[model samples]
Target: MASKVGHPLRTLVAFFIVIAALYGLMAITKNWTPRLGLDLSGGTTITLTARNTTGKGGVSATSLEQARTIIQQRVDGLGVGESQVTTSGGNQIIVSAPNVQRDELIQQVGQTAELRFRAVYQQESTTPTSQPGNSATAGTGNAQGGSTPSAKASAGTGSASAGATASSTAKGNGRPGPALPTEPPAPPSPRPTAPGKGTPENKAVEWQPSQQDITDFASFTCPRDTQYYPDVSDQPLFTCNEAGTQKYLLGPTIIEGTHVTDANASIGQSGLGWQVNLSFDSTGSKQFEDATRALSQKQSPENAFAIVLDGTAVSVASVDQAIAGGSAMISGGGINQQSAQQLANVLKYGSLPLAFEISSVDTVSATLGGEQLQAGLIAGAVGLALVILFCFAYYRGLGVVVVASLTVAFATTYAMVVLLGASVGFALSLAGIAGAIVAIGITADSFVIYFARIRDEVGEGRGIRTAVETGWRRARQTILVADAVSLLSALILFILAIGSVKGFAFTLGLTTLIDIVVVFFFTKPLVTLLSRTKFYGNGHKFSGLDATHLGVTALPGGRRRAGTATRAATQTGGEA
Candidate 1:
């Protein structure tokens, strides 16, 4: 079993097969290189400075890190690969992504994503929200911005409000009944806010709608301009439904998004199209319970609740009952698969401790990265040259094994880097390239250790095959020990480091593992097969394993080399 496992032909064949598979994938995908990091690719880099809205001390490390994680999710949700999001200088979050439009990236990660549960005091749109061809910013039909989570109420289809229709289907039969009747346009409720709104720190009180706020809602179109986007939760908001068919007047925020503990989007309990289920923390549960009970008692438009996100009403429905449990569901026929997913993602990944303002936006040119990349390659070439020179100097014939093994290792590592980039968005940074170059030295050490052991056994009067086998047994333990230390160091570095430094650690660890694979599957077996050839087996003077160079005076068969045989024959003749 051991012999079969280490057979030269078998090992070589398996090695080639793996290389073939990797090359096949590259051929099929037409991707020969790994995805380059933001540093290597020209793209937008947005630096956001987090501010404490409540006038507290600067943000804590924990809060900064939490914000970093959330922002990363938002970028990932946009499907941008090779994006780098990290905290800098404690209070700043830097986002770098490749090939993304400046405006789109800003909208995805720049918003405060302040989710508020506000009451709909007045909805004065003569326009129907269900109207087709809705192209508003918050409208359901806009391809750029689909129905966000708050676009519809969590309340079932029966409680769905105007312009947004939903049905409670019996099962997953793919059939939905007629659109539920939308409430007739009710007279705008008594003014819901005043011009003098309280700051967010002060518990927000529902305000009386000023003449201006009301007029805006009455004439406001769906997809309002950026100037009209929702602001502080203390003031009343005039915004349109995603469909642009309805306008709404929402009172002060009753609850904020931080209260949400978890959220998910899936088919409704009754198999209705889709729903976003929410689970709030203890504090959020009580606040929601109070808000729902109060709204349920109001009449007409006052009875409805609007789920506002980032100052826009994503969803609204009449509160039919008080919800005490921390968990709630948002289901409406308008909540199709795509909209449901968008809503759930926004809620689940939107948790952040502080608001961010983009302080500086810059472009990272790929040209600069390309220059850096060229330097990294030059450095790698120099390092590899040194390693190859040392191998040939120390082990003439055995140098072939070192070079071949390294070539295989290089091929395998390159293929994996490219494949991982394609499949998992693993970007190779400049630091990572440095790590790969360092790997050359690590790989060279293994061959030197193994070849020296072989020479030592041959010096002890062993045949070439015996020496090769015995040398491997002694050298493998040392090889494993050295690689283990290297791997351990790499793991620790990867764990402790952050940002681009992590790229270095990861590439180092990756290449170390590749080195071990090459040593076991290619290096050992190739050297063993090479020992069987006459030039090496007979210990030619320059074969590196030459008996003369290795200081071997006699072979196992009593054949003497390195002048020992000639000396012995001369002495015997003199005695005769």
Candidate 2:
């Protein structure tokens, strides 16, 4: 019976077709290179230790994992590719981002993300008064803060609008209160509260600044004074917007981040610029409705509510009328698509379950990363060279087959790595390089197994052409089982391991798959075609399969002299 090996020519064509498809995709994406990991491309690694703000005994695994996920989202917002955020030692979160600014990465991932909605009790410019004991004047400024010139609210549409460069001076009392203090007071006590805890009676309009609160507000300065005050839910907050151009005295938290169900950035209903639409849960909707109703009855700055994040006023929007819907929109001149999306992401992801203290920050320089990359490449090259050398020394002319198959497999693996990098943000780390090197041995082993099977058949009297098919039939199962085991191990490692080790498992599995592809489509077909050629089919001396080399009387299927078998047996016995 004839062994059924599929059409070699068609398989070879299909393999090339797949390669062409990969390159075609690369052309479409315009990304020809794989993304490098932090160790290879230089970046910052931040380690944060989680601490329960509620005075709990220890940080729970659930909270640490939740914090890691939130930090990952924040880092992803920065558009950094190949960023890694993982939990470690139960209470620590490790964040690695390649090619990111250190300060920016720290800011994004390190924020406590405590979001609160408070009524604006007072809004003032941070510009110092010209003379001592004089009231400071409000200056018109950009969206980050200063003075909003005008603000309009569409009653039930869940949208509010303010000028980008508007002066939002308090409407009723235009006089600034007191002279600014040259120095800020000592930091306030730690007044942390459960994220979303607040009562209905502590409405936005009800909380008035106490005598001490007024003193703190008078002495506070934008940017500098922010650190002194703790932004607790039930207490007043004195802080500035992110830009530090405007200062605000805010009432207790009216709504917390936990109540926000969803947020998205889009063009406003008025066809203005960008805005962030916020959705709230049932409790948040009721609280927002009540706050808006009361605030709409007040004057300009008093009518506006401050959207505070991490004790900083991100936005202060005035309400012209009651907004009773379960949704609200934040629109201002300074809110472009980028800022809107950023704000939306922060709100959408909500606050981390636990506060984190940055434990350590380590940065890898580009020069060091380049040096490490060069070392990894050198190691891989050395490994591949040794593999090729062994094949040539042992298999003679058959080494050419090994080299060609490896070349095809390498091309396939490179293309896949590049594609994966572009598509899914996969990065190649040094550990991943080690995995590829190990795969080199696995691939070479496959070729050795197939070739040995063919030699065994030829030694048993089968022609090379016939042996090609029979050898493949015998070797295919072992090759598949071996590759399958490698792939399985890689999958398990990838699932259980963290940090750079996952990179190793990823590349190992990727190369294992490419090994199977090359063996079935490229290597087997090439060997089958070579078996039909005169040089290999004739079992020439250099072909590594001659009768003399195999210790047989003559080439399989050829006539032998009467004494030839006797002489071959005698020589084989003498050599043994």
Candidate 3:
């Protein structure tokens, strides 16, 4: 009699109950999905081939990974969600962000993030004249054609050119016009001396555009307007006047984004608002120092430099001295708590070592993916039906054991796949499905070994009830060895291979494990219990383990009688 503790159906039931509870938990925790590949989701894919710009064998894998980190930061800073950045073929980087406009993402990914400071001349006071109605307003200098004595302009009240609507019309000459005179008859203060032309009143000051001015400048879309505002045709060597309250003239960047070692955003000491702290490598530090020192000596506006990010002015600050420590802080009035945090994240991520190139990017319509999913299910169903049919034909009543064991294996495997998909980023790809199909054969082989062992025991004249126990003893060793070899092969495949082949190895390993568990916990117990039943114990002709087929006569009390020729002949003659 089979022990209750080892009964197959009971164990199977308990296993299923545990799995069901886990499934419930999985459902509550997160939505499961086999993450789709690039082809299945519409996205932008950029392939960047590495160029040895410095001829130092281009970049090492480590450096490339760092570059990826930086690029990821820039891309994510745009507020796009769940972007993918990976390396491919050793020297190429692939970037994909689903549903984002390709042009916008491309511009963000390609920037070399070089920030520089350039000083601009500033005066003490001025009047607004950029508007036609404001033309009547007054402030400092002569309101005549060129060659009028200059008037001082304050930091905030400049840019009063009549009808000059935040256009980039500045002639790039770095010259500031005299402020409008406040009183028309006061005769311009005995001609105040020019700042750098030897005047006691001339002191270098910070010049930045007002917040309203930066906002106006940000609204501009170049190439649609007059020739005075040329669109950024180059990689934007310079960001014109401040988009912040402190307007600055920026020269071309001397250090690229790749040289930045780290960047973080934090609140200043006063706890007022957000600011970004930046650090650069030795080479970048020297360049930054040169840029700042040159800009620091100029008068207001001319004494400040602009930090241009992706062709827009995010901040502009003046340097009081040459920042020799290779670090600096950028304080922007518009940056708030949340935005500052995101900027910090961007800078932190922009220094990892991952590179990849998209080999192809094509959209898989949702309808088509649905069709594919349906087809995969149908294929799985057909394969299962064929296995069941073949088992029934050859194994007869023994096929029930095969079917039961396989069902349990399938349940466990499915639950794991779903859970893994939810937990890790695992996805059910076409290759993964193929792996599962291959595993079915492996699972079936384990069942065949088990049943054949039972037949072998019965042929050795053991009673059906005894044969069940003896068969399991022999099968255990064989099953363990077979499973071990399969697992080892899977490990080898997993470690050495990449892409879809690894999926195949993974499924194979998982099913092999399930096969062993079923054999020990479900199959052996079921057969042992069934052996105690009347039909199986008596060795009925259709039971697939009948004593006649094995040349043994089943008797009561766990005994079997061997065939005797002489007795058989005498009995046959009497019957004749």
Candidate 4:
């Protein structure tokens, strides 16, 4: 079969064009550096063990996987680059993030993310009251400054009153009005009896605070008492918002988070600010409509409901009319894009199937990370130097091809890493670096195969040009098979491995692909072009393809002077 050679120059040009395009994209994105992983850069690593919240004995695989995915989404929502959330043991999840606060990381991933909607029985500011009855009303202070309160009544004070009639504010317009005192006075002797459980028609007014509940609400501070209340759907909750600014005594759960089907954050139709829109299932829709209808008829704070997450009030919005549809919007003074998006994410992903307990929190210092990175680079450099030395010592002039091919492969790999980092949050770790270093040998092996094949063809009495093509035909299959095996192994490893080992597998598979590109496009084309040169074609002594070096009688298809064959024979005999 005739050996078909490709358009070497065109292939070379196309390959370089692709490389140039990668760098161009990097420049456009303004991302000049690769995102390093937790090991390479200082970061926090947390290990979590999943336990079934119910009295189940062991964690199910499906539940653990679901928890990992939810936690991963939460981490990504934080915009932490190169964060990894992977399942380790049967019930354990390993989360690694570069350059993130430990407490923030824990708070984000540790929460069960249970969401609930509860009617606000009472609302009070956490700050100390100046007078006996003076206290900031719930939803009074503007999230954004304005003459009108965002959704609830503005700040005002009156004598202690339970369920006082405070005028309800419209969605976007409402002036400050006299509000019921947030702080309750000392309970009179024989405190009024708590309301009994009533029918659904008057359920909103049925659940009144007991004497204990009222006393606890008065003494309960913002953040100090926030964690004390466990979110039970049947019980009243005394807790504060995430910012610890306002505390609330909330009625029983009106709607559980499970009913929420979708949530998204976007600019309000009024274009005033960002708002989170929510959609609920059919059952939730009816329940919500009923709850809102009843709550809308009540006085100031009672008309407002709190969207609680993990026992903290995310937002409290007043209901002017019955929200009959399955959808609702949470928008107020403090609702910005970040807060809105975070709330949306929580509602969208809902709660995890199982609760996760943080087993260990590990922090890697920047200095130690830097030292490790430096050491890794030094080892890679030393290995590359040795490879270069071996290539030159063995292949002589042909070593130039090996060096050039390796350089192209290295450049292409680096550009890909940087581009992947910017586009897909792929971070390079120490294991990834080691994988790249190992690829040096893999790339060198390809050159060695091709070069050896070329030498065999030359020894079989073929001219340099013919041998170049024929040798490639023989070496191509071997190179492809070798790379395929390597890629398969990497794929398997990536699939089966956990933690940083996946980083290694990813880079290995990535470089293996780059090796194929460099060998087929850059290396072979350059070698083909070089073979057309007189020094190489004539098999000059220093060209690493001399007759003596190749163990051949003479250079095939080369001009010969008088007695050249005689001199070649004499030289071969003398060397023997």
Order the candidate numbers by lDDT, best to worst. 2, 4, 1, 3
Worst 10 residues of 2 by lDDT: 133-142
Residue-wise C-alpha lDDT for candidate 4, range 1-576, written one tens digit per residue: 123334787788899999999889989999888888886777998999888775468998888888988988888776665578989979899998985677667777787878888887777656533212111111221111111233222123221222223333321113343333357645322311122332232253357666667566666775633235555666777776655666788887788889989988888756877777778889988887777767667766776677777777766766655666677766664567766776677667779888778899998666876788899899899989998998878777888988898899999999999988877677888888888988899889998899889877766556678788899999999999999999999999998986688889999999999999999999999889888777876777777767766666666544431244445434444211
Provide the overall lDDT of each model, using Cα atoms, as 2-decimal numbers. 0.69, 0.72, 0.53, 0.72
- lDDT score for candidate 2 against the true structure: 0.72
Q: What stretches of model 3 exceed 4 Å from their correct place?
A: 1-10, 30-46, 49-379, 548-576
**Residue 392 shift from truth in candidate 1, angstroms:** 3.8
What is the TM-score of each predicted model, taking all chains together? 0.71, 0.71, 0.53, 0.71
How far out, in Å, is residue 480 in model 4? 2.9
Task: Report how far off residue 348 is in candidate 4 (Å).
Answer: 4.9
Name the runs in model 2 displaced over 4 angstroms: 1-7, 24-33, 47-96, 119-160, 163-202, 205-221, 227-229, 261-305, 316-350, 353-362, 366-376, 453-467, 537-557, 560-576
Q: What RMSD, rounded to one decimal, does every model reach?
A: 8.7, 8.3, 14.0, 8.7
TM-score of the candidate numbered 4?
Answer: 0.71
Tens digits of per-residue lDDT for model 2, 458-538: 665566787788999999999999999999999999989877888899999999999999999899998887777778778
Name the lDDT value of residue 251 in candidate 1. 74
**Candidate 4 — worst ten consecutive residues by lDDT sum?**
134-143
